[model samples]
Target: MPRQHITTHIAILGCVCLGLLAYLFHLDQPVSVYAGTTSTAQDFDSPGSVSVVVNKQRPLGDPGYVPAVLIETGGISLRQEAAEAFAQMARDAEASGVAITAVSGFRTAESQARLHDAYTGRYGTEVAESISALPGQSEHQTGLAVDIGASGGECSLKACFEGTAPGAWAAANAQRYGFIIRYPAGAEHITGYAYEPWHLRYVGPDAAGKIHGAGITLEEYAGLYEPPSAPPSSAPGKNAVEPVP
Candidate 1:
């Protein structure tokens, strides 16, 4: 196998092994209950739904579908609720001296296709698939996923952004505003993408809080999938812990 592929495989295994150890260590504790208990299959299956789980394994319920309503905020369009929530999150972040910028949102199927094609051309199929979602399998098509950046443009869209003011702030607080770092670090294998600190997906406050609080992926939260092990939650205030890097 190629060196990079081998490295990635090792990283994935490391995360799972760490997570299993954490789960075992915390076996005496009760796993947190999912707050979004009412979420149904349609919630994760419909593109227009707030809790939709579009990914490589689950394509959009309807291809080429457009959201019923989209609203522009920070020069990017998103579903109405998501736009409003993001706007509030930005406002609060700015009040705390963290500047948040929206780099992309609400892509059409044609746009996603072009973006995927571009990545595939530059990186080849396997790498491209890990970095970019195919057209109908993208969360952006639902207008709930947004790529964020810092106003100063430092480390924008880069992994290093996770350490930047905006990125750190969002990672710690986005869930309070109904969003999550969709493809979080250490969960690339489960998420089917690399760690993208700039990618925030809104799943409503209830779902976001539960997922964030538990330190698990949407697949695990929605009962679609689970990694062999779970790392404890590292978020400061959350009681649920998982073993993670």
Candidate 2:
């Protein structure tokens, strides 16, 4: 082969190598780090696990499942792991001058049915579904979800609670304790629920961090639902700070 031809081939090979290196670098980017992230190093496929996702599209892993251990906090109960986190978060919020309290947690499937029926009866099926979960399809059934309010009872179980001090504090700090606002505003399309600032789901701190940092719902973090190209503009009730979770 001619020397000039051989030199050209070598140059082309060098360019190809550089291109491959660039591609690899792109793959190593921080956002690419999420390729390895799913409910904090665990995917959402395990219904019996802490990372399980319960929603309209999915139900608890086992219909008859109940937490092996349930702990109470302020008259509400959560699974052991979640209860601890819940207590810690409330304490931290109180230290910060925000008194938060849990209003509901660890519901039986039968209880969920009664609540759903009541809501459906009063408000119709559509409104009931937006706020209440069907029996086996509730995260509360997993003992990992809790609805909270201010200690003073300000805005209890109401969207206006977001404007309350306790609500503000939880919105900012819930992720630190392995919780996320399950139904964030503007994400109703993806979450199949309305914006409920008080509904918190504990998926573990590791998973919660990724979900909070990414400004996505658990379903989105789990690769279960794809957000729209342009998300709708739904203003979070009153105080809109920390709208991600």
TM-score, model 1 to reference:
0.76
| Residue 64 CA displacement from its true place in model 1, Å | 0.4
Q: What is the TM-score of each candidate against the true structure?
A: 0.76, 0.76
Estimate, for each residue in 1-245, the C-alpha lDDT of model 1 and write its tens digit. 89999999999999999999987767645443344442333357677779888899999867797899999999999999999999999999999999999999999999999998998999899988998888889899999999999999999878999999999999999999999899988998788989999999999887888788888888777777754777855576656656688
Off by over 4 Å in 1: 1-42, 228-245
Residue by residue across 21-134, what tens digits does model 2's lDDT show? 998876665431334563324546565577888898898767666788889987998998999999998888888788888899999888998999999999998899998989
CA-only RMSD, every prediction: 20.0, 11.8
**For candidate 1, what is the lDDT?**
0.88
The true-versus-predicted C-alpha distance at residue 146 of model 1, in Å, is 0.5
lDDT of 2: 0.85
User: Model 2 off-target regions past 4 Å?
Assistant: 1-40, 228-245
Span of 10 residues, lowest total lDDT, candidate 2? 31-40
Pairs with steric clashes in candidate 1:
19-230, 231-242, 231-243, 232-241, 232-242, 232-243, 233-241, 233-242
Best by lDDT: 1
